[model samples]
Target: MAEKNLLEAFLKAEELEIQGKEFYLDASEKAHIPSVKDLFKQLAEAEEFHRIKIREIYQTFQAKKNIPAYVTKISQKQISPVFDPKEIEKVASVVTDLAALEEALRLEEKSIQYYQSLSDKSKDLKVKRFLLALIQEEWGHYLSIFDTMEFLRDPSSWYTFKEHWGLEGV
Candidate 1:
């Protein structure tokens, strides 16, 4: 992995947030299910928030040329996931549940890796905490996407089981 200064890293993260927001907006427009459409719209808003957060951080700390102390240390855990390209086929529209879920999964997985990397690299305690918060948020997003995929795969069974287990109000 290539090393980047904090400003550069945050700038890259901001760009990613913009892309994520755009993708979510497009997905919302193309979604067939009302619930999925709402989900995408909500995620788009969240991405916008993430973008602003990163931008603020970058602007505040861009003058500092300090490389994080942890940057030189070897990472103990492999944070990146290996996904098959064939599993992420491009779609003109995210109208189908399966297609949209696949794309959402991909995005969440990528975000998880990105935020985790930032968390791992940050030496400042406050910065590390903020990055870890983002990581946790991304992990939650990934889990939600995974759950939605499972529900979409077998709605009847999943929904029924959830309702039976008193977990239907989400």
Candidate 2:
């Protein structure tokens, strides 16, 4: 396998993920709507998981090569997620569940893009594949949030097993 310079992008991905998690956590605490707060909290944890996955990739590189470049003093600070404090305060009060859902979707999209960039930069095919998987997973997360938002506001779309089985209206 060719040596990859994907270390930079991967590190950035981790930094951004951490930043996103912090945003979500902050929003969760400030949001007045219970459902929205819970949703934000869920997203915060999700971002943390994504960050862990990226860290695992770095560790894998270290374990496999036992090298120095992978073991660096450099932190993933370049692509770190940064939310404007004023914006957070403003949005926290006015954001509905739908709005928060949309923001979460955007954040997940950012993660997907970062992962895709990192994956493309990876020289090792295994790392590339792992990153691709992460990208797909992030897309799924974005979609799931959209679908959940849909379900939350539209209970008519939700069908219980009994209803689907024609056991309802009894």
For every model shown, the clashing-pair count is: 0, 0
Q: What's the lDDT for all of these models?
A: 0.67, 0.63
Give the top-scoring candidate (TM-score).
Answer: 1
- Taking the tens digit of each residue's C-alpha lDDT, what string does model 2 give over 36-97? 56667766777787788778777766566533323221233122122222333343345365
Task: Please give the range of 10 consecutive residues that has the lowest summed lDDT in model 2.
Answer: 73-82
Candidate 2: clashing pairs of residues: none
TM-score of each: 0.73, 0.64
Q: After the best TM-score superposition of candidate 2, give how far the Cα of residue 3 lies from its true spot, in angstroms.
A: 5.2
Q: How much is 65 displaced in model 2, in angstroms?
A: 2.0
Candidate 1 structure, TM-score to reference: 0.73
Off by over 4 Å in 2: 1-4, 62-95, 158-170
- On a 0 to 100 scale, what is the lDDT of residue 134 in model 1? 74
